[model samples]
Target: MADPKGFMTTPREEWPRRPVEERVRDWDEVYVPGALLPIISKQADRCMDCGIPFCHDVCPLGNLIPEWNDLVAREDWRAAADRLHATNNFPEFTGRLCPAPCEAGCVLAINQPAVTIKNVECAIADRAWEEGFTPPRPPDRLSGRTVAVIGSGPTGLAAAQQLTRAGHTVAVYERDDRVGGLLRYGIPSFKMEKRHLERRLEQMRAEGTRFRTSTRVGRDVAADELRTRYDAVVIATGATAWRELPVPGRELAGIHQAMEYLPLSNRVGEGDLVVSPLCAAGKHVVIVGGGDTGADCLGTAVRDGAASVTQLDIYAQPGADRDEDAEPWPTYPKIYRLSAAHEEARDLVTAPAADADARLFAASTLRFTGDGSGHVRSLHLVEVDAGRRPLPGTGRTLPADLVLLALGFSGPDRTDGLVDQLGLAMHARGTIARDAGFATNVPGVFAAGDAARGQSLIVWAIAEGRAVAAAVDRYLTGSSRLPAPISAYDRPMAV
Candidate 1:
């Protein structure tokens, strides 16, 4: 380790976030400006570099936290980036987007705040790109085989990069106008800017991954035609099916899905023209669901000058620390955490900020009441127990000009022309079912990421991508040397 007594001597300190008041004015990334420089080497030096790291076990990617932390502490940032890239193809993306299960799994976190593993990893990646440490690792010899990846999300990108580097011609297909899938659209720029994704895409391009956006397989091109053209096909199409609430007034104007609202704001940030736009401006916005997606909506609406915002969660508020039965050490904790959005909302509702109403936990929506004009104007809500059954005498009416269902996704868009025309089988839960090698029942076709696993972490998506690439390579060549970071049959390993 860089500092022998670093863990004992230094307390953890992290990069500071930009002041909320200043950041909400614009759509620029909320953290990057002031977040990168404070590498907090002393904090990195806190890593024990344990003989058997639970952090790795907890992380879906199994990132070498201690190795990179030590490298960062020693000021060997290039080597740190190398170690980081060994497991994660796009640390820039994961560094920004992932919730850092590794930190939660840290042995040190049993007491202290744990090593700043995620921050160190992101810092190393940023520094590497700045110092010209990252370069394309083009294959020396070409394999005559070709592979097609159907989806340009993290999974597709990683699979394409790995396959392209392994000397196979690879093409990534995205249905959206641009590549990067959800990264390009679903995710808001406030948490992570588009530049991180763009830079990584540039690297993948240099390494010879051909990208074909605005193209949907089984629509633009027949599924069978793609199979005949490519040596192998990997489906990384993520779960895009939004879980809808079936309450009354569901189809009314001013009621929108979370994806619909989030993407429009993101697109607006991208300088795109608003066509029949969904704006939260000067409206009383009520978001139903208490997950990160809901928090994201809260932030976006606040920035858009929503007259008021209220978030509702069906479950009771979680504890500030781990609950024994729910989350144990080395597993991610189930606890009440205040996100930046929650903080901003608190600032609005409780303090000086102009507008914020409430975040009602254990609250369930009974129904939406609409004016005769067919626009949503209010909602009937009730308090509920842990089982989400309504409590007696808890019903009340709340003003709601706009209701966003942030309840989360059910699975991929199975009804889309692509899945329907191809006749892909979905699991009972609506996710595509794949075997140990990520192969679907359909021969020569494979699935991975959220499309197969349902809504999941970015780390899992990338791991699934790398694993699927290995499977595809082996299928085409009858053997493979690619790193299989995960297999469909593999679960999180425990000691």
Candidate 2:
């Protein structure tokens, strides 16, 4: 460890965020630039370097967290960056977007606060980029084999980059006009700026990974014909199919899925005048889910000048602190969180969170009301039990000019004819079915990420990509050298 007693001496300190009032007006990242470097060293020093680090166990990437934490504490930025990149292809993405399962699994989390592993990881990666230590690791010799990867999300990108570096010619296909899938489209600039995604894409392009955007495999390139052309294929289409509300008045004009609304804001951030049908400006916005996506909608609508915002959830509220009985130590917990979007919304709206209109865990949307013009104007809701069932005689109505179904995803988008053409089996939960090696029933094809693992964290997607890449490599070459950090067959810890 950098300092033996660092964990005992220093209390945990988080990266500083810009004052809520100041940050609410713009789309810049919430954190103050360069504020983390000052405290990251001390934060990393708090790592106990415990025997058999459970943080590693909890991470889907099995990232060398403790080792890098120690290196950061010692000011070995180069070494820390090297160790961090060993298991992860894009530490910056996980460093920013991941919820830090490692921190939850930290042995120290049994009592005191866990080490700021995610913050330190981001610091090391950022320092490496500044020092020009991150360069394309090109293969010494070409293998002369070609691989086609479907989707440009984290999984397909990871698999493509690894395969490209391993001497195979890899081409990544995306249905969107640009690459980075959700990273480019669904995520907002305030949480993490798009420059990070662009930089990584630049590195991947330089490393010899070919990209084909605005081209659907099943539609543009016939799935069967495309598979025949490539030596191997990997699917990472992700879970783009949004779950629906199936309630009365589901066909209102101003109502939309969160996927539809979030991406339009991202498009505007990309410096384009979006002709998108979904834009949240000067409207009474009612979001019907209370997860991360809901928070994202809250922030985007606030920046877009929504007249009012309200987020409704079917479940009861979580406690400010962890509930030991429901979630024991070394496991991820259900606790109250004040996300960056929530903080921004908190400042922009009225006094109490309820008055501010982002009410959580106590209500459910029953139906939408519309005028003769077919535009939504009000939303009817009823109080819900802890089980999310409606209670009698508590119905109420609120003006809602726009209704965003931030209810999250249901499963992969199988409408493109890829799954039907290939006849791949799906799990009972509706996610793609893959065996031990992430291989589908088809011989030369495999699946990973949300396409295979369902909607999940970027870290898990990257882990699945690396694991599936190893499997594909082994299948093609009859042997492989790629590292499979996590078993594709292994089940993750349940909430």
Candidate 3:
């Protein structure tokens, strides 16, 4: 265990972010570089290493939180990295992207600030890379079986890496020109730099995991062709069919789905374009959703020099503290939290709404008003109650030259034709149907990740990836040693 009495003596100090003024000027990550390593060990020592270790139980990856915390507290960086890598294939990604439900489940969090588990994980991962602890672990011998993984997102990457390390010849197909799906295109560099992803890709390539870019499984190459050539196929195509806001004037020239706007900015960062055509410079921007994607859009718009920005949330703002009655301890809770983007918005005065923060809680969009040229000029909205019913005498209009819909995704896009060609059974919710073993209706074909689970946290996607890989390995070899963290039927914790 970590320091026996450290929990009582130590107060939690999170990894510090770069000053708002400095970070907004460039596309680099928000956190201060080289600052985490110095403070991470002390934070790790704060872990009680509880008898129950609810932190580990709550993580979708089942990350060995206590083990790594103890390792870090002892300054055993190598062992901490090993323990971290045991369940998580991509700790660096999760460390940056995950919401850290584990922290919420920490025993210390019952009455005090939780240990900085996410920061510790990231420090271990980065130190491992710097110290040359993460080498490609190529299999000793080939099993002579081959697997084709469709998509190159977190799930597909995880499954391919696991199968490759298990001696199966694995090849990942990506429709995009680059191997990473959303990680390459959708995520902003300010949140996570691309260098981390590129380094991992290099490691995977060295480990014999092959990548096929710009290859659409059902279009460029038939899905059946892959099935005939490979012994098994796994679909990890993430849920990317974004939900639409069908209110009036949604078709206006200045309005776009969050996905459509985010990728263009990413492409600009990738040097594909000098400037994004959808750049929000000098425009009054209004985002229509309150989720992570909306926050992402908010950040991107701010960086693009939006004249003003406002985020509308259908649900009322949650309280500052978790409601013990509605959401008990150890379960993920809804509370008023300030994201880095929201902090930037508040700091820059980029959002001129009545609220101190850029977000308008319990706000419902009534309609969009457009200029005579057919570009959106303003948005009409009303205050809504818990039931989303409009409140009387609360209607208002705000200047909105650009409107982005970040309402989240419904399911994997079927336009790629993979689902139809493979005759995969789908749920009414638009996700692929899978059994406990993560197998689709077709023989030798399996589905996992957002394709089967709908949109969810990145940790869940990686967990599903690892689980599906184990199931595929079992199906191929009759018996397998790979660890499966969760079953197909597993769901996120709820009240």
Q: What are the lDDT figures for the candidates, one per model?
A: 0.83, 0.86, 0.93
Q: Which 10-residue span in candidate 1 carries the lowest summed lDDT?
A: 349-358
Candidate that would win on lDDT: 3
Collision pairs in model 3: none
Best by TM-score: 3
Error of 2 at 51 (Å): 1.1
The residue-by-residue lDDT of candidate 3 on 1-495, one tens digit each, is: 768999988899999999999998899999999999898888999999888999877898999999999999999999999999999999999999999999999999999988999899899999999999999999999999999999999999999999999999999999999988889998999988999999999999999999999999999999889999999999999999999888898888999999999999999999999999999999999999999999999999999999999999999889889899999999999998899999999999987774647899999999998989999999999999999999999999989999999999999999989999999999999999989999999999999999999999999999999999999999999988999999999887778
lDDT of 1 by residue, 200-222 (tens): 89988888889998887877888
Put the candidates in lDDT order, highest first.
3, 2, 1
Query: What would the per-residue lDDT of candidate 2 be over residues 265-377, giving only the tens digit for each residue?
Result: 88888777654456667788888998888888888888787887888877777776778887876778977777887776666772143633365567888888899999999
Ranking by TM-score: 3, 2, 1
- Candidates in order, TM-scores: namely 0.95, 0.97, 0.99
Candidate 1 Cα errors over 4 Å, as ranges = 32-35, 274-276, 350-358, 491-495
| Predicted structure 1, TM vs. truth | 0.95
| Model 1 deviation from native, Cα RMSD in Å | 2.3
Output the lDDT of residue 32, model 2: 93
Worst 10 residues of 3 by lDDT: 349-358
